[model samples]
Target: MSPSKVSTIAWDSFHNTVDGKPRGGKEKHRGVNPATGEELWEVPIANQQDVDDAVVSAQKAFESWSQVPMEKRKEQITKFKEHYLNYVDEMTDLLCEETGKPRQVAEMETKGVVGFIDFHLSLTLPEEREEDHEKVMLTRYTPLGVVGAICPWNFPIILSLGKVIPALLTGNTVIIKPSPYTPYTTLKVVELAQEIFAPGVVQAVGGDDKLGPMLTTHPNIQKISFTGSIATGKKVMAAAASTLKRVTLELGGNDASIVLPDVDIKKVAPELVMGAFQNSGQVCVATKRIYIHQDIYDEMLKEMVEFTKTIKTGAPGSNALLGPIQNKMQYEKVQTFFADSKAKGYKFAVGAPEVEQGKGYFIQPTIIDNPPNDSRIIQEEPFGPIVPTQPWTDEEEVIRRANNTNAGLGACVWGKDVERAERIGKRLQAGSVFVNSWEKPTPQAIFGGHKESGIGGEWGKEGIKAYCNAHVLHTYKQK
Candidate 1:
């Protein structure tokens, strides 16, 4: 695909939204196209005043938006969904340029956003009940006023909507702050919502490091939903504590995939590759570590390497299955792992120690063969295209190893026997456990982390409820 064909949206002034209109700031930050080492577009760098304006807008909007009928809110969301579907191609192009993900993956993220909207629409507000004569009880969910939502660059649209859609549906207004790395697509998405939602109902601001702290610590903001690194998540949590604001964090994950001895290597290898390398392995739930039963370890390793080689990596327009790393910071982070592996003389089943030098932040998809469990590659979440595989004999030992990490957003178990796979999968301490697949979360499943991975979750009925504050109403009889 040519560059012109991939992106048709005019690259013009990208501004922040306040109340329901686009507003520009004096200071600006340039968004780079990771696939080509070129500036994609310039977005405003929001300051304290901009943050204040956005939060105030959201708070004011919540006054009325929170009072709107549930059916009306759902109708607005349905309209937003229809509009998004119409421009899927343009959105996919913008997503690809900003994030360096393939067109297919970009499209998948857009589709995922639609699924989130549909799921929220399927839920009803908490109901009222009568326990006995002259006694009534009501369990109602109320919005948390102005919700501060911070989204990462990876899967920007879906992740942002994961907070935006639920919060709006539950009667809360939102002030969204998207990662500077990929702000255009998110801003555009919010811009679309402005048409359906009332001013302040949905708003977005783009800025540098300072923006996040401002959003979290804002006094008017009642709740926060953040998706990023564990370190930053801690900061967001601590800041929110100043006002004792409710927080929901989706953090890092060193997710593990455990392969039981009874599986077909051919069928499982491709799935494993997809699990580990999708979005160039920037996925939080991507399988970062793999543990194979020693009996089939050698055969599985061979099959995995052959299947991995078939995956191509290049710039955005190429027929590459994988695009460049999203940004320079991640590119350097992945390079450190390769450097350490080289120093320790770690053997690679596929990729080499050298980086793929070119116009983009491209790194070869690498698989390490049986690195020590103590190695950084094994213990840390690299969040790149490299993954490490180990061999295990005992089921209990492998389960322990998989659960050893502080991060546990997602885990997977593969085997021919369903009962056995479920048995092993249950032991892995992760939020979403996959039996035959990996890195795939349906709209209805609860997606979250266990330990350092995250606090709270998104998706399912519980996800929509996360944006709400539960209130109980009781009435006594005239007796």
Candidate 2:
């Protein structure tokens, strides 16, 4: 059979095409392009039955898949990795079209996913680690059966792949529910996965928020990994409690970037913007807030503004530096903060009050100066291209302000002196800190949040542990 492009899938394996079953899965929702407000696609809303079916499928596939040896699982993943890389360009275009992200940003997201598939396969399912029989001590990691993965809209393909692929690599069958806004690209991934794995080994259910709770509460789902808001993360946790399911929650972040007195924001402003507004500030780890030292506050602010002026804000295909804000609600929420901040008394050093281009949700690369710390824009997770910055005198005070929020995802402190930056970075409350530079996610490195930002890590050896269970082999010796 030829590999035909499929953007949707049925809840049951009985149909190779779309499900013709009655419309009991809630209501059909239309996904729109944030850039043009055009109807991109309509995804079937999965109700309780759909979620139940997904869980049952995953659980069934898990029995046989979990029995596969680690080495064999690794080999299958290796083949899937090769096939995934060949399809990166296709995936990139789908991302751009669906998410309205910059072409380059979409490419980077797809590239991360491609690398993630290869990385997890190479890291997790290795042949052997020196077998030890002396102490009756042995460590074998096995899959947690069915994994119900709830992914966010931002970097849909990468985040979904980042979670599901690793779980699949470690022998866990997954039922992924991508955020309704950006399910198209992820559905494409599921289509590709079906060719390599069993029918229910890696399945996707695209629907509203309701499907998530169903999957989380399902008796068969052994693990639940979610990436979204703090409130929702809590709810997911609470729902999974009854089932006693292992849960991993990657939540919100209001990350900070500090520029020490000696460092030049002019030299680092581009990097800061890249880190802050890469996906139009829809990133969980984006530097949403900046706390610059008083000595260089004006200089850094000026440089940031100048650098911001050079950035391109347009539709996805333009290869612009920035893209749409991902969804309608997010765009309006961001616009409200900008409007409210300016109305109350804050200043926009750069960026317009409104969106620059098509009706699609887009925000100018905005920089707000000295907004009140108690203001909603400063205290809350903006999750947009808006960055609120202020000056501080004391190092301790800076750390205090940075850690004021409930989020402790990722933070950065830049300075000419690496030691000084490191000292400050260590003090900040975050999972990962960057001294002088922001480090992108690497396969060998662990990436997750502290506090409310996330419960578990992804993209490393530790990430593999998140998907597996340790077993001890005991052998009796007869003398």
Candidate 3:
């Protein structure tokens, strides 16, 4: 297929919802098209009163919703999936307009919603009763009441659904609070569900960061599933502590990638570029740091640099491989990384060190050449279109260097020597380690953080159990 051209005409306005209905908030906020700095549409900003109403509705609905039985709940979720598919095209446009994601990337996130639902639908809730040793024992996993699904601006649709689907499939109601910058798609997506799910079974509220604390600390909320940066995640954890709510935080990742001396530079260079710059390197698992063996460091970095040149960086709707930063705050944050690199006089192997802000938040993809191990770019999560490359001679030392940071969400190793790659991968301190390729999280495998990356698993069987409170029953058997 030819590359998608930069394009967008117009779209209808969206709204926040409560009790499966579109509801207005106390204030109004305009959604900006990050690619053009244009105000796309206005959305209602949920206030304290709005959050209280949504949570109360969700809590009220949970009484019946949680008891609806897993199979019945799945039926409603299946219906929600159908609704999502029908409106996915529209969601894609809103996603791109609001987040400045390339057309293909936006579509991928929009469609990924179904994949999450299908996987959750296929999963079975644990309900078992066993009798052994003249005793009766039973085990069950049940919902933990209303869940607060707070989403980040990056990859809003899939990440939001990743939290919402499991919560609903496990028979828990949800109140979604999307990032203020990227509210249109998430709010509209939940609006689609209102028709399929019962009143208050699912709802979405829109607001700035203030709504996050409101939802997190609300007593009626039994759980908080947040996906964002580490500093904000710490605040979420602290807020949840007020009510002692079950918190699942998928925070920032300073993920690392290791390339051994034996790998094919031609074959792996493109993958390295994607690993580092996918979604303009804003992904939680997007490789923040790369360690290439000294034997092949120059050649590998050269190939990776050339591949990055082939990546088109511009507005969404074009054949551009990357779009602009989603919001001003994050754009400025990425700019600071560039500023620090320039101040310290670090070598930039790919694009320039800094960008001039104009109408859009565009930052051309860049690869920072082998900065010091303790450099700011190496130790921090930029969440932008810049990556740091390092050279290593000894495997053991490289492994130690890779695992030195507190942020360990994902890591990867690439080499033809399967045994050697797996050996080094095992020692890497991360929640998920990829052997020959960067791991794309599926519903089948569990993905999460190791140190400060996150608190709980997000996919697979464990993901299903996360929303539930495990219960055990003991009965005396006739002897």
Candidate 4:
């Protein structure tokens, strides 16, 4: 079946999409175009009453949705994926306007969600297990009911749908609450889903700070999947505790990359820099720091600095490869790190050390040359376009420094020999370790944080298990 052009392509943008329909909310707030520093448009804020409508509807729908056949569910989800692709280019346009992402990068995020849906379709719940003696006992996987997905501003579309697809496919309903900074695309996608899904099967609500706690604390929500800073993730966990809801929190990371002496500088420099600054260094797993073997420290730094010359930072609509920070709070937070770096007199190897005032929240990509291990820029998540590099005389010492942080989301190891790289990669204290290139996580791999990074995970069969409940059924011989 084909998607109706009128219903699938058009989005009002001003209202929240709830229970498969558009409606007004308690209040409204305007989102700014980080590229131009102009108000893009006003969006509704869901108050307590609106939240009640969503949860009530979701609970009501769960009665039938949880009973639908898996094949039938897959058919509807496939339709949603097809409709999403049809609307993706338009979604990218809105994403750029609101999130200040380069058009290509934004398109990647929007389309990546489609890829995630495709991967989830290949997955099936564990087959029923039986143990027999005088009787039989079985294990079954069951949907946990209504799920609340709290997405972050960076990669808003993919991250939100990443949770929604798995939850819905597992026979659970979903209520998506994207970060207020970049809410439109996710809401629009959910709005369009009304055509393919039963009312209340998929929903989206946009709002300020209060909305998150309200959704998390809602006793009816069986699970909460959150992606954001470590602090906020902690708050989400705490709030969900009152309801004893299951949670999957993918929090922040101060990931580090180790560059061994034998690797070619030219081949790895560009990938290294891109890994650190993609999405303006706003990614949770983007390598925030680099450790180079002393033998190649100077050469690696030199090549990385020269490569930074090719990156252009400007409006997302322009040919620029990098765009502004998505919001004022994050922009100013990054500025504080910039100021601290300057006060401490660290030497910059690329771009200017100063934060230039612009109409938008743009920061020129800057690199610090071998700053002290204790430097705030190296130790903390700046979440902007600044990075730090340090030299290591011993392999063990460099690994120690990289593992020093409580963050263990992801780390990288670069070496000419693949086996050697794997050896070093395994020693790092991250959930995922890249041996050579810092590529994005594929749908097949499970991703989450260790230590303070996060709890639970996403993608792969292991991660999707968070959305389900395992039950044991017992059978006995009858007379």
Candidate 5:
């Protein structure tokens, strides 16, 4: 679709939903199409009052919803899943316009939500265990009432559902607060939930800045699940501490991929490029640094630069393999790294700084060669499509360098020698390690970050349990 066509499409004014009904606010903010830099729609800027109403709605619903049988909850989720699948096409277009990601990426995210829902359904809650004949202990996992979910702009649909599905299945009511940059698709997701679920079971509110703090600090909210930057994660954590609310944070990462001398340069170069530049490297787990064995560094660099030249970047819904950077603030952040690289005289193996004529957050995919490990591009999470590669000779030295970062979300090892790769991958200080692949997270596997990367995990049996509070009931016979 053309930019004008996308801009002129009838857009809905997203507002807060409390008790399954739409409520508007006096203040409002316009949604921008990042691809064209055009205003798409105006959504309500939720104030403290809006946050109060949303939490109250969730609190009221939790009392009754938490008591419903697990089977009935599964049925509701199944019905919602069917509805979501039927509306995938429409949702994909909305996602593309709001986030400026390719249609394929949007569809991939839409399809991934079903796996999370099904995983929650397949689980059986913990049961009572007989410690002995006379003494019995029952382990009960109870829901935390009135959960508040704050999702980031990138991958809004999946991340929002990532919190909503598990929290709802575990019998907690939720109020989702989506980032102002990309709130349309998430609001649509919550709108669909209203049709299948009872009032206040699942709700959403959109805002620029004030709404988040209100939701996080609200006394009525018992748990907070947040996915965003570490700086913001810290703020959320501090705010939730006042009420001692349960918090699960999935934050930033500066992931690395180690390439040993045994691998084929042509085979892994393409995969590395995709891992580094997917979503314009806006992903929290996208590979940020690459370490190649010094013996094969030249060969791998040549192959990677050649492969990167073949890929295209442009607006969404086009033949472009990669889209714009999603917003102006991020666009500026990526530029700082480029400027620093130029000032420090870093070697650019593939891309250089350039200016686009029109209004869009566009940046060419960049690859730097052999920058110092302490450079800003290597140390900080750019959250954009610029990656640096360095050469290392000794395995011990490389592993130490890889583990040097405070952000340890994901890492990868690429080589033909499985034993060596496994050994090296195990030593990396990351939450998830891949043998020959990168950024591959499944619903059944546990995913999270170590150190400053994140606070809690998601997308496994443990992920479902993150929303629950364990209550142990003990029985003792008269002695």
Candidate 6:
């Protein structure tokens, strides 16, 4: 398993289909490889009619699938997982090509997709226990009719699985509208899923977001789960309101990574670099804001800079450690953060806006020093690789500033003192936090945000509950 060995699986082309009829959306957009500036493929931008067709398909499937026994459904899903697991190479390559993530990151996420399927299997098949006596009782979990999922581009395969699998496990049918920027990869995965699950039970549709409202507000859909920017997430929520649909949003984050004075920077630096910019900083939980104790700030910055400089950035299959921005808009957005920060008087400690020679949509791994709290780079979620590092004199003050943002998705604390890290982790408003390690969405753990970051989580037993509607049953003894 040499790191240099390039791995790519040849995946079949994805076509837009409805009821086994191959169809194309009203318009089409080109999916480009940001690393090479090459046009990789074109994805059809679905129209209102296309959304209607998909939703109808799902709604129709729910009628029959919802009646299927849970054990039988689990058996079918297990076979789906088997198929999905066998094609890990294809899924990994598709993700790398579409999202511009390095091969290792792609493989990691491919593993995540498999793990998500396994997680749903674990949660959906809770042990059936006998309750009080003469009156037979069964606590049942049923799906919310038709589930609509709007997936984000970063970690598309894994995030899609997080939402789609849970909905399916609960006996609900789903229609996924993948982020057009990275739709093909997920579509291919779903195409494989169609083998075990019926065509309508699990489906994917790609299109311009303008059509999303139609899916959200459709009369048949009972719940909506979305993973993307806060702005877009709000839009989805507003639209779902028309149908009074149950919704779960996994949105934007300006997650802060607090570096306590006694923390080990040598160990922390590499993790922060990966956490912040693993996918060119396109991650929602990317460590955007870093607060460090003044005593160790300078030394930590040196280590962070040296570590960031060592990462190689290039195409997906390259021997590089980092990859290009997923798209041009993201590249431009990263540049704007740089231009605005400098105008507001921030110093660059590691890299600059000007990318290396011949790099395509690739910004150097940047670390800004002591930017003002009010600055856009600090106050707003960067959603890119640009991170602002500031010095905090007091522990309480650091927690206050970290929780100041409307977002509360994730946070990280680094300190050699375990007790101090735990104390700080408790005060943070984020849904998830890691002490001495950066944020990662594990299948067994819960993942979501607080406030504008998101409404509910999307993994673990709690995550499965989001897709199900609970009913209470009471029995009266005969007199």
User: What lDDT score belongs to each candidate, Candidate 1 first?
Assistant: 0.87, 0.78, 0.87, 0.88, 0.87, 0.80
Any runs in candidate 4 off by more than 4 Å, and if so which?
7-12, 128-132, 477-479
Report the lDDT tens digits of candidate 5 across residue range 142-238.
9989899999998899889988888888999999999899989888888777778999999998898878889888998999999999999999999
Model 1: per-residue lDDT, tens digit, 367-417?
999999899999999999899999999888889999989998999999999
> How well does each candidate superpose onto the true structure, as a TM-score?
0.96, 0.91, 0.96, 0.97, 0.96, 0.93
Model 5 earns a TM-score of: 0.96
Cα RMSDs, all models: 3.4, 3.7, 4.0, 1.4, 3.8, 4.1
Clashing pairs in 4: none
How does candidate 1 fare on TM-score?
0.96
TM-score of 4: 0.97
lDDT at position 184, candidate 6: 84
Better of 1 and 6 by lDDT: 1
Candidate 6: worst-modelled 10 consecutive residues by lDDT: 1-10
Note the clash tally of each candidate: 0, 3, 4, 0, 0, 1
**Candidate 3 lDDT by residue in tens digits, 1-479:** 11122232124867888887788866888877878988877888889988888888998999999989788888888877876676668778778888988889888888877777888889998778999888888898989999999998888888888889889888899999988888888887787776678889889998876889999899999999999889989999998999999999888899899999999899999998899889988899999999999999999999999889998988876788899988888889999989999999999998886687688989999999989988999999999999999999988899999998999899999999999999989889898899888757677887789889999987788887889999998888776
RMSD of 5: 3.8
- Once fitted onto the true fold, the runs of candidate 5 whose alpha carbons sit more than 4 angstroms away are 1-11, 128-130, 355-357
Model 1 lDDT, residue 144, Cα = 79
lDDT of 2 at 363: 75
